[model samples]
Target: MMIGLHSAPFLAMVAFVVATLVRGMAIRRATGDRPWAFASAKGVQRIAGSSFALCVAALLVAAALAPANGTNLAVLAAIVSLAGAAIVIVAQMQMGRAWRVGVREGDAPLFVSHGLFRFSRNPIFVGMMLVGLSAAIVSDTWWSWSALVLFVLSCIVQVRIEEAHLEASFGDAYRAFCRQVPRWLGLARSA
Candidate 1:
């Protein structure tokens, strides 16, 4: 049975997945290098990345299985999810060739601190969290909420790893940028 076919949550999740895949494909086509690194990760990175990917899948499953609700709240959540998906694509584009799924050994992309990065050091992750939150809201299911929580936790671990890599690679420049931009999003400090 095609349950929850018309649910906004399911639609939003689909949209986010489509946007991410399309953008990733475009980036890969533009550059010869593969942008994906989940499969190549090891140790903690491997665990976190795999966990995040699984959470995304769990959210998709939960959304599809949840009961359909066409309330205004669902529509709002869909809109928010769409915005989040857009943010992911836009931030990725802003990073341009610098965008990557995970850290690569000796693969030093440019230190991006403009566009969406100026507002949030981790805009891509922020957008992902938005998608997870919206999926939970639209689905209104225990499974969806649990998936969202796991998604957030996984992101936290992954972000810390990426941040450390950036700091080591970019040194003072990365630290200065971190000081100017909040981890997520907020008013920039004047200093």
Candidate 2:
């Protein structure tokens, strides 16, 4: 069996995860607030968010352990993975101090509508989904593909939960934004 542990693509995935965690920590420190608030999520929201995290871990493990296909498609997948990482970083930076891993209750952060937000309501989620998809594509393992499917489902549920919270917090403003921007990346529908 070929080992992907020493592969450049695997290392890049690891680096992306580490960089994201570091940025999350920095955002928490700078804001002096708990940005990793998934613990506060209850019911389905918590389950969905937790599932997304678990799927991400599964993808990481699969990426490290599974042999890459070494096909042109794999190379394309690697490029997509890098682009996803870039998207995550850019979206997080655009969010700045308001960047959060989970919903922070009792406090409504800024209604961000600039940069990537202009195109997608949840660019970070889009980026993460891309990463998961790329991981499955490159790994070419049954379990990795299954994990990607699960990740997408969980991500969708989690996004819906967050949207509900935003709507409740921001009311008409959030609704208006939703009207102007699609949930995923695309040109805005007639609004």
Candidate 3:
């Protein structure tokens, strides 16, 4: 059966929204803080999160509804998504205390540079990108691809904002870490 966007995309969209909202809320509740700062440079984090959710949804829709002919693209996307998820989970686990949805100015309960963090500065984002890409590939639609692009853009902007906040909070420590680690990508030694 040839699945199309009409049916699958909507379901994916719903799932994405629910997942993000639930996750965001959990993060908020766990951290006891909001993720957004109203006075700051707008709501980049919110926007980015929203964009990522939408893109992921679209990709999921495509994957489910589209026929599985075992295309190379779909296979690759699946691998990427699975790998990314694993990496992100490891990173999240390592960053137990420091894992908050929004920025925190004070000293983080923990400064994790272990596990996946030792490899990639932003393993979560990398995982997210892989998931987003997988969705696009699974969907095999222009819209899915577009979502991938938007997701990347959102991550880029959000990362910069996050970096500024982290630098302010961590000062030289963060600067030194940045010097050692790449922003989105990871080096071989750590991986």
For residues 59-175, what per-residue lDDT tens digits would candidate 2 score against the true structure? 888767656456777777778777787888788889877777778666567768899999899998888777777778767789999999999999889888788888999999999
lDDT of 3 by residue, 100-143 (tens): 55454563554566777766788877876776666666666787
Candidate with better TM-score, 1 vs 3: 1
Question: Model 2: C-alpha RMSD to truth?
Answer: 2.5
User: Tens-digit lDDT track for model 1 on 1-191?
Assistant: 55442355566668767766776788789887677776688999999989998999998887676656667767777777777777887887898878778776666677788888888888988888887787787778787899899999999999898889888899998898889889988866776
TM-score of each: 0.89, 0.90, 0.74
Q: Which ten residues in a row have the lowest lDDT in candidate 3?
A: 4-13
The per-prediction CA RMSD against the true structure, in angstroms, equals 2.4, 2.5, 4.8
TM-score of 2: 0.90
The predicted structure with the larger lDDT, 2 or 3, is 2
- The lDDT of each candidate is 0.80, 0.79, 0.63
Q: What is the overall TM-score of model 3 with all chains considered together?
A: 0.74
Regions more than 4 Å wrong, model 1: 1-6
For every model shown, the clashing-pair count is: 0, 0, 1
